[model samples]
Target: MVISTHKMVDCTSPVDAARLFNAFCIDNHNFMPKALPDFIKSVDVLHGESGTVGSIKQINYPEGRPYKYAKNRVDEIDVDKFYCKFTAEGDVILGNIEYAVYESTFEPLESGTHYTMVVHYHTKGDYVVKEDQVAVSKEHMKNMFDIASEYLVTNPQLYALKQ
Candidate 1:
């Protein structure tokens, strides 16, 4: 139960690359990741009901971090091209989470726009692996897609909103 999928592309627009990947996953509180010492109280959607789709959010897990109650479910929403697919339940980050899909695709690249990003997740655990563990879990999914494509390219305004 270890499935990892990550992809990235950019120039922008599937609605500004799905609103910069949904504001880099709900405005990650500056993100540090190491058990979050000083801060990192990110994740807030609270009750989504806008634009389109089933739109439902209520994720706020940062009590102590590490697989806390992370709720998410906006199954599939397609705004002409931009997309949002999710299916998180409780304990996130390598728990029984499945069907975590976030997608985008926009093309018009002669000098700009050409975004594409995807993440599909499915994993549950009891634990029991020996042989190489799928090449160290695909090198930790290429270091989590190179730290999420270097935090979406060094935080493009944390997914742009500067019009």
Candidate 2:
């Protein structure tokens, strides 16, 4: 079975939006872990070097959390388009599904920017994925994006300079 979810968020500026999206693509170590310390314990580059395709980033959660770690591989990335795709390979991600793919895109808007996330869940044979499970996962996903958005908002000067 296959399940899909789509979410969209508005940001302050096009460059900031693209940078925020790129931050997740490359800043799990310095930005995400630092900005959202409560949820993410740390992000270690387990396999390949980060900031490039094929790199694997492992994220650790706090103790007593639902899952311990999630290992995601950078499946595809487009710098020009400000989009990225990751394949989640961990117990939490593949628990009720065969595998999961997370895709994020940052696009320019007239006044600000638009960020969209699409999650595709592939379930095991003869198995069904509950909505509640997907909801929780979606919330988890939202928290990450919210934190990154907050970071970009609070540090406007920094992102503005990058633009």
What TM-score would candidate 2 get against the native?
Answer: 0.83
Clashes of 2: 0
The best candidate by TM-score is 2
- Candidate 2 lDDT, 1-163, residue by residue in tens: 7565544332344345556765677666677777788888898997887857899988898887878988889888887787888888786665557778888787867655677787777776756666665676677767777776777777766435342
Instruction: Note the Cα lDDT for every prediction shown.
Output: 0.48, 0.72
Give the CA lDDT, 0 to 100, for residue 63 in model 2.
Answer: 88
Pick out the ten consecutive residues of candidate 2 with the lowest summed lDDT. Answer: 6-15
Model 1 per-residue lDDT tens digits across residues 71-133: 565666555554555565654545354445555454444433455555556555633333353
Predictions: Cα RMSD each: 15.5, 2.8
Backbone clashes in model 2, listed as residue pairs: none
